[model samples]
Target: MLESFSNININLKFTIENEKNNSISFLDITIKSQNNCFQAGIYRKPTSTDNIVPHDSCHPQVHKTAAIRYFANRTVTYPLDVISKEKEQKWSEGLIQTTNTIGNLLKPKHNNKNDPYKQSGVYQLICPKCDMIYTGQTGRTLNERLKEHFNDFKHIYRKSKYSTQLLGNKHPIGQINEIMDVVYVGNKGSHLNTMEKFYIYKETTKGNQINDKNTVPTNKLFDVVILQ
Candidate 1:
């Protein structure tokens, strides 16, 4: 003869409130039967309350309340059935272990090699209000670009009268604003030249008009040329 047999069914539903001032609530219903007798249980977690409590009940039950504030707004449901106490305990332990393993696996891992500033295919903005002119190159280091600019200035000054006259006796034509050096990795050819020209024009214009905030002077005597 069979000693005992049990059947259990569990249903869970929950609501979440993301607002700081609001709350969320949920209801859980459980039904169990052994031999000929049946038992029903109801659980409720109210928004104002910090603990969940089980209530005795029979037949179908309905539980309702405000939402919880401290927990993430999510709901999970599972069914439970058992024929013996040992089986029930084993099933519960297995569920807990599975949930913990999944949670750990989903967590983000950190690595030192990741560079947040390294970007490709885009233009970077430099500060036009700064004291120095920042010259930069794509696909290369800012220091490298600065070195190339100085080399070019030196070579051209000896070969061309225009470069000698413009550069004059200045040892370094412009100081490198290290803080404002931007690498535009995506811009190509004419677009890159235009961007460089724009930066130069803006910085020169702002420097010349540092004292005036009103309309630009009508006289063409301005130090910087405005390229339309």
Candidate 2:
């Protein structure tokens, strides 16, 4: 069986043992990959396709609540808290995790208009008219960085020495206000600088990006996928 599989560039995994009747039995086979693993069960005997069939009674019967509770108990890294529904009598093992450790049930939720950029990540700002793009990343939240961009526009208006080249007369005026769209690329925290450099390199190669060119160092590696 191993030789047969090898002929087709397929690897077969199993163990064979001699039986009392001068026969061989194949044990279970295991296969592994980067993110997952699989195991094949042993067959009692070699049989033709016509004689082989799946047993209907061989299915596992796992209770949903019991399974949830079992995993919840094992995976409770932080303090575990359960919230029963209002006026509820049934014991619900299904959990709703919260950052709050204080037993406050009525904590008011804040609904900010710009809540999407509350995460630390790499992002892109695109111009509507010329399709020019600016690739950036933030150690803090994206909203904070975006606010800085808006402040740069204000500096441009006041003719500050620190005026942004992103909105100069050479480029599109009021380009910040005419932003076509914003994109959230990835959440690489400390590695934001490297990731941002990677994106800037890629965008500049396309000849439509507004970012000033700089020599990217080849010393670091990042798991970046640029789909053009």
Candidate 3:
């Protein structure tokens, strides 16, 4: 099956394996064979960590709420049966999870949002009028970095490549939501830098990114995650 799928697309590679114990996992979800039918639910691998980002981690609100949004969206969007619906509802309601040793629910802790580590990450900013996009990374809050771009555009400053070009082209000024998308979040490190470059390469191949080609070279590894 792997060879067959690999041959279907010369540029792509495929891997196949058999499901075991009537259950199999795929992309954060698990599928189970039940009475000649299939049921799906959230899945977490044994190595998964229950730890979460610190409240004052400086991660954007989007990043903080991503998991909740995903769970809520899945609960509402997936065509789950009655029993699955109950299970999902209970899980989504926070009825479960968050216990220490005695199975008693523990209160979550919070930190002062002012003093914090910079939540570095890769992000994309788009030109509303021309649909052009820029891929970049920063060791700061995404909002902070994006605000600089907006300011540069407002003042016609040469501080940023993307903002200067957007203004020079006489493009319409847009709100942050109109142009920015947070792609990945991490600390200031090589991983964050690599992800930024990878996204730039991805957009460049699509002929949309305004940023220059990144130092990260082309690799076949991305094919595993990318859709054919």
Candidate 4:
């Protein structure tokens, strides 16, 4: 025999299983209607079945569907509150004037408006060991420019292999203890390439008998350029 609620309307069935003691045992179960289909537990003798019966109600199985629905509802409601709070905090902090200045400094200026290269000063370096002349340019103050080079000169050293190899492996600009002479070729808004070439040639060939412009020893290596 089997039992179920009147509204549920489960159908009943029975089967017989032969026991080891020669006595026949009856198995009864219910079938439920599911989407115009039927489903039921398998009919077998309780003694012959080795499978463990589940508890009357498991917490996870009972609550899983409702838990998922609750979390889904919370996800929809909570993200808006989080975003609103974030916006409020950002508004309260406001924008700093120093932040604006820093932003302007980091922004890239297009050469279409004005030539950035022309508005920067040029630098020249002579490797005492190789007699190789290098040219460079910068918009930052001299001390700041030199500090930047010292901080990140490995990248430049890697690129200018010929210059580093010829200079007896000396550190670029700042690492060397000895002071090297530096001359300002020209102010901002000028042909930096021409100015650098002219001054480099002039200084290198001043007392020497090298009359040929092409024969002057120039490394043509640039380490860094810091734009304002």
Following a full C-alpha superposition, what root-mean-square deviation does model 2 have from the true structure? 18.6
Relative to the true structure, candidate 3 reaches a TM of 0.46
Cα-based lDDT for every prediction: 0.36, 0.45, 0.68, 0.40
- Most TM-score-accurate candidate: 3
TM-score of 2: 0.38
After aligning candidate 1 to the native by TM-score, how far in Å is the CA of 145 from where it should be?
A: 3.3
TM-score per candidate, in order? Answer: 0.24, 0.38, 0.46, 0.27
Q: Indicate whether candidate 1 or candidate 2 has the larger TM-score.
A: 2
In model 2, which range of ten residues has the least summed lDDT? 83-92
lDDT tens digits by residue: candidate 1, 108-205: 22233533134222222232333333333354444454455456667764432212333553434445453224433433466455444443445446
Where in model 1 is the C-alpha error above 4 Å? 1-144, 153-180, 183-185, 189-194, 207-228
Q: Model 1 — TM-score against the truth?
A: 0.24
| Candidate 1 worst ten-residue window by lDDT | 64-73
lDDT of 3 by residue, 31-60 (tens): 889899988877767986454443444799
Q: Model 1, 204: alpha-carbon shift in Å?
A: 3.6
lDDT of candidate 4 at residue 10, scale 0 to 100: 42
Error of 4 at 106 (Å): 33
Q: For candidate 2, lDDT tens digit of each residue in 1-228? A: 855655775464454444433323344221222235322222323441212111222345454244445444433332222321221112212132322221121121223455556756566776544567777766677667766776766656623211344465444434433552334434565445655666666666677666665545432222233431
Global CA lDDT computed for model 1: 0.36
